[model samples]
Target: MTEATVAIALGTRPEIIKLSPVIRECERRDINYELIHTGQHYSDNLDQVFFDQLELPDPDHHLQVGSKSHGKQTGEMIAGIEDILLDVEPEVLLVQGDTNSVLAGAIAASKLDVALGHVEAGLRSFDREMPEETNRVLTDHVGDYLFAPTETSADYLRDEGIDDKRIHVTGNTVVDAVGRHRELAAEKSSVLDDLGVAVGEFALLTAHRAENVDERDRFAELLTGVARAASSLDLDVVYPIHPRAESRLNEFDLDVPDRIHLVEPQEYLDFLELERTARLIFTDSGGVQEEACILGVPCVTLRENTERPETVDVGANRLVGTDPQTIHDGALAMTNSTTDWENPFGDGTASEQIMATLRQTHSVRTIQ
Candidate 1:
């Protein structure tokens, strides 16, 4: 790589997990880079613990721009990130996933004329109602290098008129992270014993998306459906509640069934252990869907559609929105479903490919 320095910006637990492989490769190859935390998902449990569990180096910069209204949060992040870009003057600004952090990083880098590279690019739920959908679309348009996770995602980028030269078909980094961490999780996590749940005996649940959890009716319907599934199967459902979802639960005064156990958020390793061992997984999380597919677990997605259509196409996932009966039926079917499908994500070398592309292509168009 000709550039003497580069910067990778991210915030939120999913970003940390997905980006860990890239960070490690940079370190291994002795590449000059800095990690910046936008602090979009700031909290000890949500953010800090991921770095510790993943063994990633602490960030060189922390904007500390905690959560707020969408516009306020993104505006603050753009300002914070612009200041850092001015000081660091990196050759390239790399960001992962569709979050406020990714959008802020892309906007700041583009405005500063620092080449932008987006990982996990080209994914689209096509639902403009989703804030993340807007973030992904904007980031992809601004990014000079789009590291798409699959041919399907790459096709999405092409259809949007992105040139082939700028889009690279690198597999999703989540596969790389899981390959590196799953064995370690098996060795380290006691979540199963701690929660008194055995392998293949329980269902894993997570609902954090605003479309599902922030709306009282949708949230109530999701829980009711999940409860019905648990009752029918006589299987315990373990849910590691997100703080935002927990607040909504209290606000709505919704009752959780005894079969569904609500627990505090687990550390990354613990959650990985749970995801690997659970009989079936039900989630509204994009990352979780990818993880479940990679682990060969059948998944019931609590959304009308997914950006990850490959999972559904491969029979590893089923999308059954928040309809109570539909959700229950999907869970029942997935519980009896086969986990024999292939993982459409990559073979775990995505980070290396990303770094290699940046080095071999010298894709950075501007350095001032």
Candidate 2:
């Protein structure tokens, strides 16, 4: 244990949740690691609360880079990150999932000769139209170690000419987070009671994909479909409203109905509690797809395709494109389906597995 182990970077809420387990791993193993936050999200709900709730150390460094066009935002982060790399110069750079920040971090590290380990690597929708697909592919290509969340995602990497030895099928970290938080959620959460929804009496719906949110008709249609679907079941539809989606909701003059409860997005612990008790879930998010699967709740994905094909492969989720009939029918079907899914993601030890790989790859550890 001569050299300090790694430098890890993340910018969004998902990154925080996924990386929390690994940070714990670093502490347990006495591995020295630096956490860098890029300030990409810049929302109290999305970023700040995640840090405080997860007890993630105040980032060793923060860029405070506000939002910008995709290219400029990413380029600015790349330059700033490269400067930081020049300073800490740790043995490995650990990054999470597909986002501009992760892509920028990978680019900076690769150009500077830093070894990169991509957590939540190898996921693909195979649609270049999706920004995430590009981010995942490019990041995996540069990563020295790749942690795949499912067999399907691993196969995707192998097909793309990734080094077979570099990829490991460690399960999704959302599942890890779910397992780590369930009891605490049950013990601490009152979302269900506050919403006045009995156990297993509601469908949790969350949709804020940029593709759907930007088009007024598309946005109106999505809410209309949810209103129709949830109303049909006589089930409560609890939407922890996303701010971006809220703006769109207003711009489209879409009045969120009484049945469709629009509320502030809950923090990690509360959201997981809602997921645990939810009868079903509808989302345009990759992370929610994985979370519902881990909790054994049926999911209707509003997106056309999912990167986590394991959910579809296991019959735990159904993809319904933004068409109103398709979305309505998918949600209705999910209400009746009683399928139980064994989590494809590993057994809540992805962080430990990631650290084990880091140790093997970099050969170093020190607390400070």
Instruction: Pick the TM-score winner.
Output: 1
**Model 1 misplaced regions, further than 4 Å:** 1-4, 363-368
lDDT of 1 by residue, 1-368 (tens): 12336799998889999999999988877778879998888484568778988888889889888889999999999999888888878888999999999999999999986899999999999999999999999999989899999999999999999999999999999999999999999999999989999999999999988889989989999999988998898889999999899999999998887888999989999999999999999999999999999998889999999999999999999999999899899988988888899999999999999998998887433224
Instruction: Give TM per candidate.
Output: 0.97, 0.96
Model 2 lDDT per residue over 1-368, tens place: 22335888888888888888888788888888888889888484467777877777888888888778899889989998888888887888889999898999999999986888899988888789988889999999988889988788889899999889999888777777878788888998787777788778888988888998888888777878877888887877899987788888878787775668887888888898888888889899999998898888899998888898888888889999788788889988877787776778888888888888777766666665
Against the true structure, candidate 1 reaches a TM-score of: 0.97
Worst 10 residues of 1 by lDDT: 359-368
Cand. 2 TM to true fold: 0.96
Question: RMSD, each candidate, Å?
Answer: 2.6, 2.0
